[model samples]
Target: MSFDGRLLSGISVLAAVVQSRNFARAADVLGITASGVSRAIGRLEERVGVRLLDRTTRSMVLTDEGRLFYEQVAPLLFGIEEAAVSASGAGGVARGRLRVDIDPYFLRSQLSGRLGGFLRAHPELTLELVTRDHVGDLVTDGIDVAVRFGEPVVASAIARKLMETRVLTVASPGYLKKHGRPVHPSDIAGHHCIQFFDPVTRRPFDWEFHRGRKVLPVATLSRLYVSDVGTMVNECLAGTGIAQVLAIRIQPLLESGRLIDLFPDWSGETFPLYALYPSRNHQPAKVRAFVDFVSKVIREPPAHR
Candidate 1:
């Protein structure tokens, strides 16, 4: 109910501990002694009248109540930090740590090559990329923004639509040489297609082709099933099977003739990429900087050499 001096200090220390997962490390972050950090948490727990954390010599974990408390507390803490940063940056310059949650494939395939330029431009900014199979709790994980391809899952967060990438069906030259390219959507059933899973279904995405108002669904023969985007691309490159992937991800390979679009005419299917933040209001400057950078990258892809 109130931001008393001790309560605010305790909250900051608690957030640091949860993030770093160790008292000594948290103390280093807070610039306080480990014993001080301990006393602060003890006071916070006593003030809250619940056990927030259970600690042993080797590890410290959030208790059930602690987890619930953190779910509510972390967002408030993030908002306070964002407010401080906004007020501090009168010139609107982006600074401080900007942690982003993104998928591994997006990181390696899209941002990894261009990140050096971003870092060089904002010398004061500290960027942390947390690559996950699924989006984590933005506030609890201390993530500033989550850029991913799919629907936004966090209902309370602000969602910004970046761009839609086309779904493409591709195969290697060697595979085409051996099995021949499918001339029609129906022909896909006879080819050795590489199956990539749908995260929601935990099964291979159904093969679908679209052209104008027409849609065709094919039951294809998949020789192998892959759980990862990188694996699907690698296997396709090795001429194992045909793969369905986002065009943005395989643009270079397509330009190099390493991968051929099997159904270029049927590339009407697309997926949305969204940038999600913890709150709709009070967005920090650092968050805006990264999101703008992402949009620029998507709009102007690197030319394939």
Candidate 2:
């Protein structure tokens, strides 16, 4: 079949239909009527000489040929769209809404305090920041960028290391005054500890510590358990118990003498921070801007807390 001017439009509509799972939805995305979307797909199918969709009154599914075509064409379409965005307006300013899914703790500790600078730097851009303790499916959630703790696992997205925050054992001055400071990791077992439950694993996270070559998770018992990072911070602030937390989150408190680091020599483990995005090839300018800003902010020690 001879290529024509309508080829790109037809392929785009077909891809959008598959992505939206309905012609009406695809039309909404493409800023056209549902009938127009149907015609675009039909014209493309006629041109290609194969059925692209299995349609019913209520729903439609991709045929084998359509699936193969979509799989090959979707990435190219994404590249084209991104290229247009990159070249649009004067000097190609990054002007768009950035959907960011961030770790709740990281948001509270690092981003919430430093966002003003980023927003001022890119006034044309808007930000939608969603905070969650557990990472969700990025594509399904429509997340443009995700900042998460731990190693990156998503194969489809590019993960950039932002920085590492030390895992620290900390306590309020009042709590330490009352219970006495624990000099060794072993002493933690006898003290009242506030434990944070892992939302994903459904168990209290083990307190990991190290001194020299000896690194281990201290299985200390706790009567208080919290699932949320904010709650854990509050509990520690209230002088209820000693807690293991990310040092960056409690830096201000430590500096202000509201909290004191406990077993400093033993508490040396660091957790990696990562920024994940859909594609390296055609990353939106807005996504690139946000990622760069966040990396800069988190990497600076003074921005934390």
Candidate 3:
């Protein structure tokens, strides 16, 4: 029997089941149903004219012939994956599911509205956006790319600096009008400051201010504290209090006059945003496409411009 496309597909399914040691685990990785995996394996066994697996109710074992076949097939499958990625990246037609882990604040402010445009640009691509306050283990999470605020600490992955984003101290115009505006960072102590806490640290983030060469970290007293960035924006808009947040998200509000910059002269703290992936050696087309798209978005000015 000549090796054709159907045989190759069967071999791939068999290899996944053997490597994962379970149909369910293999299905998860392949993004297929467990029954589909079982059917594929059954077809493969029939085509090969051998019972590759010694199947019991509780578990399965690769037969001697199956073991030999697996040893030969697994490497070829991996090579195929590498080749596919290389071709896809070079062809610039990004397809397949692009799983991304993002900082929640960044999502709320920067990417939420703009995601639809990216998907429309590449109709063959599917996007999975996972957001949280704390950084997760990329391998365990099956994340293709991770977008994070501040510097990344993943030594194994390739980290690309997307941008250095400034932190802005801002308040709603109504809130500022009612409570009055502060000219200096020190003057914020008298206002109702809405605070955000780091998810991993569980401590309030200190407001950062820059004046010439000196960087100042101020711990302002706050009656309102929130864990989510969206909530902080809402509270500020509702005239609940002043908030210090990333400037990227608040640019529209700033331009529309919904929020007023608290200390423009002292805005100095810049945080690094990183796009992280498994390795730089053979980056997947979907991941590379997403990184390039996001970089373009960040570099472009707000709609007001």
lDDT of 1 by residue, 1-305 (tens): 76588877888888888877789988998899989999999999998899988987666888878777876777677677767766776536778778899878988988887898999988889998898677766655666799988888777667989998999999999999998888987898888989988675687888899888888899999779877899999999999998889988989999999999988899898889999987545677788889999888888845921
Index of the highest-TM-score prediction: 1
Candidate lDDT (C-alpha), each: 0.84, 0.80, 0.80
Cα deviation of 257, candidate 1, in Å: 1.6
Clashing pairs in 1: none
Ranking by TM-score: 1, 2, 3
TM-score of each: 0.88, 0.79, 0.74
Model 2: ten consecutive residues of lowest lDDT: 85-94
Clashing pairs in 2: none
Tens digit per residue, CA lDDT, model 2, 195-258 = 8887777888778787778897677878998888889888899999989888777888888888
Please give the RMSD to the true structure for each candidate, in Å. Answer: 2.6, 4.4, 7.5
- The better-scoring model by lDDT among 1 and 3 is 1
Model 2: how far residue 152 lies from native, Å: 2.3
The clash count of every prediction, one per candidate, is 0, 0, 0
